[model samples]
Target: MTSTQRPRAFRIPAADQTGAIEGDVAPPSTVRMVEEPFEIVEAADGTPVPVAPKSRAPWLSLLLVALGGLVSLGIGLSLERMISDLFAAAPWLGRVALVLLGLAAVALAAIVVRELAGIWRERRIELLRARAVEAMATRDHTGAQAVVRDLAALYAGRAALAGGTKRLDTLGDAILDVDDRLAIAEHELLSPLDRQARNAVATAAKQVSAVTALSPRAIVDVAFVVFSAVRLLRRIATIYGGRPGFLGFLRLARSAFAHLTVTGGMAVGESMLQQALGLGIAARVSAKLGEGVLNGLMTARFGLAAMAVCRPLPFIREPAPRITDVAGELLKGSGAEKPAP
Candidate 1:
């Protein structure tokens, strides 16, 4: 009877239990569930955001700012007239005041002109530099050399126009500088033992030659040729580049002539403005009998002010952008993303 006893029934722990007994085999151990880290994914369907354009301070806006000063001068003159009876008693003093004002105005105008000219020259230099870089990149040595020569010539002409021997010297110095740099580059390229290096050097040399060949004499000739061509084309464009109608022809003529006329008129206007400023100052000073002290003082003050505005003084005006904006625009237009932050 004892031998026939039923097999012992054993209790097993549930799947969640940790400890196991010898009589009871542990139920298959439950795998401890682990949570994998959640990854943040960017949305593939999102539209690319457009970059904001750089805000440039408009040249016209700067011109207008200077106009404000001119307007203030007018206001000051009007005020002086309104208080004329007080000044009338001392006609000499009035005359002196007038002379000082005139000198000041002439000085101011001259300074502004000089500054504007400098800005123009700087812009031209930047343009030339860009052309040179392009020519160099394309292995157009001739073109690069031509650009360098032209730049040097331009600097020389500008210096001459500025009435400074130093600037003239700068022009010669610039030419020498370009020659030295080209020579160095040429040497590097030609001296390389590797065939690849030699080829590259040869290519660079060709580009250098292109730029260098445009000597001062050649640049002058090319400039004359271009100027003549432009004038001729402008005339032709005026006559023919229009719709087929009497009114259209007239419009076309006017439109074509507009730029030339405006430029000519501006030149005349500037000259007249300068003369008027000078006359006004002279008339005012002549009426007063103080030694040239008032005139000299005014001139000195005005000259100083003008230099402050015109010269490339540090921390006064930020340098104009050269390549960054142009490169950015090119990249954007080509549907390329900006370089990573």
Candidate 2:
């Protein structure tokens, strides 16, 4: 008797098909790719997650390090000379200077500790993401379970996730498949945080758009943009459990920029601008309002990059945030959307 395999559904191939396999990676149609291709792998969900290429030598990091060292050395020397002069001038003044120095030293030490902790938190997120990727690649159920436990621990303190965290804790002996487990973890743990992150981004975009439109001076626009960006980065990190301090924020920003470069996010950002402009045209937006839309688009673009960096897990159970989605929301709230007649 002859036996035949059942018919299967068709998909547009991203690569040439061999009889045995379609391609080395998942199809691009399944994944929402940015301009650059980082090579796609199927995520915990059927959709693929694209990994960005490693960036070039970290010149920004080197510059930051050199500048920090130089400033620190200059400050130490200045303080020492000040204390010496004060002591020579008067004993009481010297005692006062010493006391001030001690207090400053303690405060400085505390700041250093917080910065290190922030860096560690960012690193921990990177490690966890890597682990999940590794588990997905290898189909290592044990490793995936461990990753889930670690993720649970990371969000244990999040009041919103308390119930999900407890449920995740019980899944160790329940879920068997690696992808299924990871997907479940993402659904339970990262879903609420994803909503919050999206909200933060949406709010920041609207604020930047509003401020830029109304501000008469370029400097005002620049200052507000910077302020909003820094706050948005911190808020995104906090949402994802990064809790980055200043130095950590710098590191986070660098990673976000790297991500942007590798993913060709700037081009997509341009696409966002184009989309916004299209909306603006329909609504007969004024020149100033149009400019505001572009500025808001830029902020939203960078915020998306930052969101990608801060996210602890890859997009598994949900679609990654698209520039168009955020821009649509931003435009609808502003004067860009067409008015109902």
Candidate 3:
């Protein structure tokens, strides 16, 4: 090398090539650029999207209602003509028939009066429950205690709810504040009573299979199913501190039918549980063993639904009774040995 050689120019090495020490060199970026998943584009004013209308089976229902009205009118006319003919032939017999008809009408009116009274009671109880819930939510100890007292009085005859009522009463007398009292009431009183009511419905559903299995005719099966469902709903309602009577049963039946209609005629008969438990109305009409079983299951579902409708108070923490579980237990042919699913 020459004595006076120029100094070599220094150059920095790339990190990738030289493997620069960590924390000494800049690192590659971890960020990525991405397009937005969706874009909102403004649409022209007055433009509308077309959609199919939902059918609630209104037309079919209307048609049936009209047909029923016509039939009822025809029956009334025919009955009137027959009564006139009977009066002309035998005035004494005609008078007796009139008296019997009047008595029957009076009996029907009495039933209507009883139903109205029960409905009034149900509304009052429901209002009480709502007020109690509101009081609990607002942390009003005095109001909540008053509600508890009223509920206890309403449930005086319910032996199963005695413990819960007593516990609630004790809470009202204790040093616990509103929140504690409400929490304890829900845990110690409402929850247990709810469970007991649900268990009662389940137990009734389980018995449906046993009772229906013994029926010789489809009509008999259907009758037994309906009777069982009415009893079950009443039992469940009573357990939950509600009074379910004849009108209550009718209300529940109407709801069940409406449910069937709204489901687009989807056969409840396909479900094994529906087939074995309740409302076998579908089964009766279908005239199939499988359909009958499905109808039975439907009846159980209706019973559970009726209980919900009849309950004076909303459930605090417990879940509503499941028709599937109750019906499943019945379909398994082990009503006594198995509990609800």
> Per model, how many backbone clashes are there?
15, 0, 13
C-alpha lDDT of candidate 3 relative to the true structure? 0.62
lDDT of 1 by residue, 1-341 (tens): 35877689876668656355456556556544324323332234544444456689799988998999899899988868844754677877777777877898899888776556544554454465466556645766566456645533553433322333243334443434433434432232212212222232233322222332333454653454334323323233222111123333233334334533443422245433543344344334432211122222222222222212212111112222121121222212222322223
Candidate scoring better on TM-score of 1 and 3: 3
Most TM-score-accurate candidate: 2
TM-score attained by model 3: 0.49
* TM-scores, each model vs. reference: 0.27, 0.74, 0.49
Decide which is better by lDDT, 1 or 3.
Answer: 3
Ranking by lDDT: 2, 3, 1
Candidate 2, 26-71: lDDT as tens digits: 5456545455445766555668687777779999999999999999
Q: Residue 247 error for model 1, in Å?
A: 45
Where does candidate 1 stray beyond 4 Å? 1-74, 77-87, 154-341
| TM-score for candidate 1 | 0.27
> What shift in Å separates residue 30 of candidate 3 from its native position after superposition?
43
